[model samples]
Target: MFEKLKDLKTYEAGKPIELVVREFGIEPKDIIKLASNENPYGPPPKAIEKVKNLASEMHRYPDDSFFELKEGLSSKFNISASNIIIGAGSDQILEFAVHAISPKKVLMAGITFAMYEIYSKQVGAQILKTESVTHNLEEFYEIYKEQKPEIIFLCVPNNPLGECVDAKEVFDFIEKIDENTLVVVDGAYQEFAAHKDKNKEIKPEDILKYKNVLYTGTFSKAYGLGGMRVGYGIANEYIIENLHKLRPPFNITTLSLAAAIEALKDEEFVKNSIIKNFEEMEKYVSFAKENNLKYIDSYTNFIVLYIKNSTQIAENLLKKGIIVRNMASYGFEALRITIGTPEQNDKLLNTLKGMIS
Candidate 1:
């Protein structure tokens, strides 16, 4: 076994409703899982219909070329289909980048997504991170000058922390970096960020000018297609060509491809999900303020609250069939709660209020 594999801890995902049922004996209908940043409304109706309609076609393999899906993404983003590479999920695209670069060192924000570090470690790369929990581009640039890392990961509208950096600032910072270093811009939450602030939007077409940069996006967030497992990366032709070399044929299911394609056409569904997300999110902000709790202003579907006894609170919530993420693994006394539906949020808020008071 590789030395890194011996010590590597498996990535811990949020507790699924099935697992909660098995462990806590909670009834499925009674549970409101706000642990994963899933769309509370679920996948788009069009996607649901597509998946249902394609149920009989499960025996057929998905188009390995992904021509239609790529075409849809290209039209939506105003980029060439040649510039796109589809993945099982954006996480798989991250894996391809790590393998392709075979980097000696990887750089990322101190407390962003965990997969970046996990994937890098699998290839024995030394992981580097910014000192600040939130993204600080100045620190990143300084470190880049000193370290000359082979790969740098910028997770815009950063996960867990729920903060985003301005796109102009990011572009300016990238302009200073050496071309030998590949910059991976993970915008898994970009749809939400762009809806919240126009300046936070980093267009694939705008970034495609740089051969060294790759922008990754997923339909799983705002599109409400988390189960579909569809994601893609947009870059200059050269980058996409190389990444495709590592992709497995028919990596996505036939149903997933169709669902994503249909989800792309349902603009109203995505818009409503983002709008409802922010509307529900405001309630969280208000609850935090009314209770005098500190929180990061969220650009994404989830919010992190810096609270006392977060572990205890999380445990209590879990007992009551309300699933929320405890930030103890990230070394913080906080809770990262996904914004749920109106009724679900009320249940969480009322339950939380009693515990804290």
Candidate 2:
């Protein structure tokens, strides 16, 4: 009987348009996917043009060291290349961080990025999950006193919940965690977070002082490079060197590296994307208010709303060709809606209003 595979919960990715259309007998062209927190503005024009030109390089292998890309990122972030390691995505670096350290213990607040818990189980590591949508430094310290796991995963502007623990709170928690433990701060949405008034940017140089904290960031979200899959980790040289052992040579492709290098130069593109996101968020909030739907304020590109029979609502919305994430599995009875172009957002709002009634 194939020995009952390691008991794993299947990941519920936001329903794809094809799947929804087939399941509901709807037209594919009518679907507007706003479930995933993707950049609606799309990739920077320069990056797209560069990716097209670099297509011929597919015949050759990528530089094993990811030299030019790393140099570009390091210069932009004001960190040395020695302190960085490029990966297929930040999630890959997340796995590498855990693999580099042992004896395989994981700690994180509840309701963080679902992948953190999933990846912990894959490695057969012990997981110490705190039971709170948000982490309080005092409560985290109490938990640390009890288990003191070897590694901690902290997602800023955390997924599902979309809340960020203030920098001072994070610093305090770091001071309280066991000195030997490594804290991995996954800032997958950091570029979106640049405008927040309360949270501070976790710079690469700052890691020198907090040697135990390793920060992972991705180009996937803000740069609209999700398909390219290029990301990086910034940490102390020692930790980075140790993690490199677990990284495969040529893990990131040449095309991705090239696109990332060009994207880094287009700061204006990122700035414009952020401005659009903020504007759309305001409209989303106003729509939610007009409809009387309760939503949490979010710094990221997505807004989460609490609703009754959320799965049914999500399904109904899907039938009308608007795909939003169903949070029923998260035990929250909520749906996370990603901010999109003005017209797309308006369509989603109109569809959702109809579904709710």
Considering every candidate listed, which one attains the maximal TM-score? 1
Off by over 4 Å in 1: none
Candidate 2 per-residue lDDT, tens place, 1-357, comes to 523326756667777888977788778767788988888888889999988998988888888887788888888888889999888989899888876775467888877787777777776777787777675557666777787778888887687777776766677778776669898888898777757644646665666577788999989888889878988999888889999999988898888888888888899998888889889889878877887888887878899988889989987887778889988887878889998889999898877777776
What C-alpha lDDT values do all the predictions have?
0.92, 0.81
Cα lDDT for residue 282, candidate 1: 93
TM-score of each model, paired residue for residue: 0.99, 0.95
For 1-357, candidate 1 gives per-residue lDDT tens digits of 576688677888898999779888989999999998999999889889989999999999988888888898889999899999999889999999999999999999999999999999999999999999889999999889998999999999999889999999999988998888999999999999999999999998998989799999998888887888889999999999999999998999999999999999999999999999999999999999999999999999999988899999999999999999999999889999999999999999999999999
Candidate 2 regions exceeding 4 Å error are 1-5, 21-29
Model 2 residue-pair collision total? 0
